[model samples]
Target: MKENVFYGKGMGPVKKDYPDIYEAIVGLNDAVYTGKALDYKTQKLIALAIAASNSDDRAVKKQISSVVETFDTSKDEIMDVLRIVLLTSGMPPFVKAVNLLYEVID
Candidate 1:
């Protein structure tokens, strides 16, 4: 199994069956998450937005939980990102993210 990249739902089989690919994914995760100019929180917020925009419920929840545990993120901060999702990805994703945020936070 993958020692890194622990948030996804599909990595287990990939890790067991395709160790080389899993390592590459881990490398990519490290490179992407190691913020350059945006800083860690900003990068995570962007990831949250992307997850929300994609309407990925599991990813949205994971991102919210990770953000909450890893940073001092406020509900307003997450709502701020969701607002962008509302405008760009429409009401469905925005609403889903809002609900998931509540589920994760409360």
Candidate 2:
């Protein structure tokens, strides 16, 4: 399985040192990201929104950077999601998401 860009540093050793567990996690990720009700892009957006809403800086950056790197998501599109973060998650999370967005775009 290819490494997921979003996996945290805590997971690095798990992938290298625990091959079976890493395979299991990769399978689970495929199950979740395979898109059922929503299409792939929409699901990714939802994931990004959730990450931003949680105010997890690394998660937010990883999600945004992964989308930009692995898919065709645009800056305007990401900013739109961050706008929703502003309304639903409040200023701190929204600002942090926006900051990460800029860094990713650059």
Identify the candidate with maximal lDDT: 1
Measured with C-alpha atoms, the lDDT of residue 95 in candidate 1 is 95
TM-score of every prediction relative to native = 0.89, 0.84
Q: What are the lDDT figures for the candidates, one per model? A: 0.88, 0.83
| lDDT of the structure predicted as candidate 2 | 0.83
> How much is the lDDT of residue 46 in candidate 2?
85
Among these predictions, the greatest TM-score belongs to 1
Error of 1 at 54 (Å): 1.1
lDDT of 2 by residue, 1-106 (tens): 2235536776789889998998888788888877668777777788899999999888888888777766769999998998999999899999989888888888
By summed lDDT, the worst window of 10 consecutive residues in model 2 runs over: 1-10
Candidate 2's error at 1, in angstroms? 13
